[model samples]
Target: MLAQNVKKLIDDKAMDLNSQGDLADYVSKKITILNDYIEGKRELSEPNVDDILSEIVGFFTTSLDIPLEEGTKFLRARTYKVNHLEVNVPKLSYIPLDLSELATLGRLNKEKEPVYYGCIYFEEKGGVNVAFSESNAEVSDNVNILRSTAKCDVNVNYVGIYDYVHRQCKPRFMPQSMFEYFEAVSKYQEEKFSESVFLAHLLCDAFLSDILRRKKSGNLYRVTSILFSIYTESSDIDGIMYTSVKSEGDPVVALKTESVNSKLVHKSCDNYRIINDYGYAKYHAIHTHYGSISGNSVSWLKKNT
Candidate 1:
């Protein structure tokens, strides 16, 4: 019964891939080879099993244009106990990407970003279950079932046990804000100073807001002031030099209190005031705000944090 059900699952998957024309022949041949081994007509070596798995993973990555590393993570195998029988199931989660905005960005300059959708897949003892959720839903579930298979008492050796279910997912790495900030830097390198400055301002606002939230002080004014003070003081030659030199005072206290203007009033006013005060001049103007945070400041933050 298990063998028949597994064959049906493979046939369904092969039918889906076969619809893609050129991939049809390849899928048919591989499925036949796997079925031969499963039926005991031929022996399946570990390398042969790996090759089949690679071909399966390649189908997804090639079709979706996703990186191989990211695509392979979706294919998994595990053993589960059901009615005292151990069942091994493999699953695949496919995520579709909206390259429309990315294509538009390639053609013209724009601030709009691409969107991504979410998809989840779970393979039961004999069937597959799928679910859809928001784009922000966590999809990278790195559950390694193969590693835990040893704990199972039943040693089922059917090749069909490695069969997987594919259901159409959603997407990370660097922080989006930092990515935009680096993009602005690239723009600056291209001599698009105006666009760079605009992006820099956006990044600056985001950075300050992030700090405020992380601190959770409820006093945006004080938080912004402290960050601005840290930036400006770090920019000074003496301050930069003294950072490396051991100081008499507590480094944390000095970082918080030093060079911050306590008298500055108004939240919105202080926000831009800190930006401009840090030397982020207008178009074609030198003394960039990016220069305000010195290497010493970064080192200090890294050490303290």
Candidate 2:
């Protein structure tokens, strides 16, 4: 279904020579990478999965131009009142530290569990990305089915497949571009699309539950799922985004950064892992930052992940 979705996205769009060629090139690159991972000719290692999830999430929110302030809620109520999903979240127990925080970080600590952040539904699996944000890529004329476009140039295969496969759901609340906002978010009943689409179901479940709970409780606020904290040298700004969490506890957390020539070597985005000593973290894949509590960061870290 996903591959077909990619193909149709190719077929329907009306593009000029340059844009069409660029899109074709982009889709081809993704397909080649996906094929290798699917066939095991090459695998998206534990870290790579993190990278892909980041990109996937990026496609939905940032690259698609969906702002971090905008939260993805379920179209409707959930059928399965599954609350222990955190316990069942997908895991990669030994992904090495560098891959855990990010594929680029290059730290390797295999002694601990590699963290994984995805879920499986209806036999399909999906995960959120660690670094999915508009800042990572510039976006324009983002197209997803719910929104309508008379003529525009931005395109990606994910948006194409969603437009066709999830055609039933009207495009609601699109980025500044003209898209119809669904009066109420749609809901999936108890049936599944395919194993590949199961993760969407899980997301639907989690998001709906969150939206409903917030509606009732009122103190709840949904943060962007892909959380990040970054500072660019030219900008001289410290920015942070929290994912689906309301962490009002810590007022000040240390930034363990190094000064490289006049630049800073700071941690971009890493999930806090178990701390070894002196507030330094010993993490495997997907673990980076940890908070010190009760006079010890180690004990607190162990209980969190």
Of the candidates shown, which would achieve the greatest TM-score relative to the real structure?
Answer: 2
lDDT of 1 by residue, 1-305 (tens): 12344345434544454345444345546556654554456676645644663554333211101111111111121111221111211111111123333322210011132111111112321110111111111222211111111111211111110111010000122235433433433333224223333233233323322332232222222222222223223233111001001111101111111111221111100000011111111111111111112211211111121
TM-scores, all candidates, are 0.17, 0.22
Residue 60 in model 1: lDDT: 23
> How does each model score on lDDT?
0.23, 0.22
C-alpha RMSD of each candidate structure in angstroms: 30.1, 19.4
Which stretches of candidate 1 lie above 4 Å from their native place?
1-21, 60-305
What tens digits encode model 2's per-residue C-alpha lDDT throughout 13-62? 22212232233334335445644554456645545544543443333211
Off by over 4 Å in 2: 1-22, 43-62, 67-166, 170-305
